[model samples]
Target: MEILPGEGVALVKVGEHRDVVESRIGPPVHPGRSSRAVYETSPMLVLTYTGDETVELVELADGDGDGGEEVFFDGVQLTSRFMDDVVADLEAKGYEYEETDIGYRFEPGFAVFSMGSRWARDLDPDAAEDDPRRVVEGVSVAPYEYFAEPAEEEIEAYISSRQSGGNR
Candidate 1:
């Protein structure tokens, strides 16, 4: 799918019909609320639909919790190589973005660009560590605290640790 600027995404407008979204993308894995729903097109790629029936956002759960989620405009199956291409395309189109430890946050209009890897811990309270699948599998796009800004020290530490080939 081609990503147009803020005007329209994929084949659907930012705030358009739900049927178009379903037809283009397919039904969601979980039941939706009156206002929003989430679709897991792949283990690592997720799509968000608003109450108004527009595809609001797309998120990629990176290996660590630092990068920003992005506004998804079109459907694309994700793999390591495919993600790189998508990010490059978004950049080529002049999508303004910010860097984080985990990923990049593109400037968003249809949806907020931000990271969700941190939320993996919440899904398994008793586990010794976050399930790695949480970052590689699907994630919920609900409004949550996972997107909060990290402290400067925390960000620096994460980068340093990653650079040193240490686990975070």
Candidate 2:
């Protein structure tokens, strides 16, 4: 599954990208740009969380793998690798995730932080607090946190680093 990165992360985060998205971008990294993050699955829907206190519910597709095809919501095809990244970030925060029949879910916001209401009820209400992988439309839900800010040194190294080998 080819998942599209939040189409305007940079634009939405830094430049003029509001027309493409709904929520306002978050902090220095833009504090709230959880635009609908739909994934290709059996029952797809608009998933988003732009640093809001409550999650919003929108009736989208019925999960048909075509979620990625829709440009209206900036569909990002959910894949195992994507889930791996989410798990990695969560694990960094000392969180453990259990694989589900769906995709992947975690705590402390990221992916599991703001799941669609239709997607939220699938799991045990008690499961939300303890579960790392909440069920969303029969699929595990996760965040494409790959767009998140990197560590300071990492950022510095990247900013200072330059292309060396050109014709070599």
Candidate 3:
């Protein structure tokens, strides 16, 4: 599974049950907890899961030459095929995921299968917290062009807020 590129640490919504989580990034770096597991997919990317669903994705920018990870980007990417494989894997592993008119429901309003740019974008403040209608036709299953990097100001602000313990 190709982990798409961009940046951000998103909290993925998960089902109530705690059991297996299906991921191609491999076993988690931390798996002792029944509610969550964390995986460092690469030196730059970190993923977290609860039950069979992903709950968070954190992107670490390359070291500042002093060998420190820098938090950056409010954007991240996951391909359509990747979403399908995750659902298929969940089903194969005996997990159930609910699909609705909006998209595959993830924590009520969010979705594991929806459309957007490779880069993450802010939700409209006026939109409902869990609106699946954000996407055209309520679902997305196509590839998108890779994202160009976000502005330095955006990156810096995101990093600063993250370091100050703000949640995105």
C-alpha lDDT values of all predictions: 0.45, 0.35, 0.35
TM-score of each: 0.36, 0.22, 0.23
The reply for model 1, stretches above 4 Å from the true place, is 5-13, 34-36, 40-45, 60-96, 107-168
lDDT of candidate 2 over 20-65, digit per residue (tens): 3334423323344455554333233444444442223222332323
Best by lDDT: 1
- Cα lDDT tens digits, model 3, 3-42, are 2222233321222122333333455566565344445533
Error of 3 at 84 (Å): 38
**Order of candidates by TM-score, top first?**
1, 3, 2
Give the C-alpha lDDT of model 3.
0.35
Residue-wise C-alpha lDDT for candidate 1, range 95-164, written one tens digit per residue: 6655445444446432222234344354345655644422222222322223447789999999998988
Candidate 3: RMSD to truth: 17.6
Among the numbered candidates, top TM-score falls to 1
Candidate 3 similarity to native, TM-score: 0.23
On the 0 to 100 scale, the lDDT of residue 162 in model 1 is 92
| Better by TM-score, candidate 2 or 1 | 1
Specify the poorest-scoring 10-residue window by lDDT in model 2. Answer: 2-11
Ranking under lDDT, best-scoring first? 1, 3, 2
**Candidate 3 deviant stretches above 4 angstroms:** 1-23, 33-36, 50-52, 61-168
